[model samples]
Target: MALILRDIAVARGGVPVLEGVSARIETGQALILRGPNGIGKTSLLRAVAGLQPLLEGTVEPDTGQMAYGAHADGIKAQMSVAENLRFWAGLHGTSDIDAALTAFSLDGLAGRLAATLSAGQKRRVGLARLLVTGRPIWLLDEPTVSLDTASTALFGQAVDAHLRRGGTALIATHVGCGIDAPVLDLAPYKAKPRDLAGFGGNGGFA
Candidate 1:
């Protein structure tokens, strides 16, 4: 199924971050989200992944086929590289770990503890989990962070393969990951400030 986001308004702590954002991504296509910091790119990704509440509008996708990878690597430091991948694969009801390891060039570090890997290596391992998730839609937030040039190219290849297999990706990145995709600039959708009297607690705005 394709992902359709229409007139979406997103907020963080009751303060709006993105307003009137609309985009559509068909299967086998990639949509690269572009905007400066604090423009609500991450919020939009989270909204699509069902991790954040949408203040307005709708997103149509088969929830069961969606996967989200945020700024955090989500890898356990105490676990081995392969162990971490296997854990995620099992969680997603899959066991094909070899493909993921090979996809990210993680085969060599499969037995290495995550605690000892370099930043780029860890990022690679984190991205590899997407392959084993068996999901068709990827919501990636700053996915290329800390990746070296070679690793970045590897990541791009993985996305290319995914799209070729009829999977869709909504990527939020500040750097070019080499994916030739349509750009979805979130700048025009930036939220205007509103009265915060009703917003409880911090009322933090992105």
Candidate 2:
């Protein structure tokens, strides 16, 4: 499936950050989002994921077919690694988590409680959830945070496999995930100061 964005506008803390943004990420492809911090990369992903509304424009085919991975690990601290994957799998109407575990090299840590794992290990578990989601489009924000070089490579491989299976991804990261996709710089799309006129300084909206 192709994920299309038509002149979208996104905001941060209710204040417009990016506007007139657009992109078409076709099946089996990934698009990298590059920009300075607070430039609305996360906000754009949030808007695409339907976690927040768009300030203007549209994201095609709805967000039900998309899975989002934000900065937070989104793993349960009390659950074991395998248990965490299983939980997400169940929510997304899937049960097989073995592939997800192996993808991120979590087989050895599968039985360990999430709280006992190191930062990188938790990050792996968090990212592995994307696999079991059964959603074709991934909206990830700084997915490699706290990951070592090796783990980052593992993530790249997983993304490669997803693309091979006709999945699409939109990732925002400072470091590369080793994928051979094109980059979409958000700098030119920065919202102008005049665009904030009616927002009232309290931000804009929740």
Task: State the lDDT of candidate 2 residue by residue for 106-187, as single tens digits.
Answer: 9999899999999999999999999999999999999999999999999999999999999999999988888889999999
TM-score of 2: 0.94
Give TM-scores for every candidate, taking all chains together and pairing residue i with residue i.
Answer: 0.93, 0.94
Q: Give the runs in model 1 whose Cα sits over 4 Å from its true position.
A: 195-206
Error of 1 at 168 (Å): 0.1
Cα displacement (angstroms), candidate 1, residue 162, comes to: 0.3
Record all residue pairs in model 1 with backbone atoms less than 3 Å apart, i.e. clashing: none
Candidates' C-alpha lDDT: 0.87, 0.90
Q: 66-129 in candidate 1: lDDT tens per residue?
A: 9999898999999999999999999999998999999899999999999999988989999999
Model 2 global lDDT (CA atoms, 0 to 1):
0.90
What TM-score does prediction 1 earn?
Answer: 0.93
lDDT of 1 at 90: 96
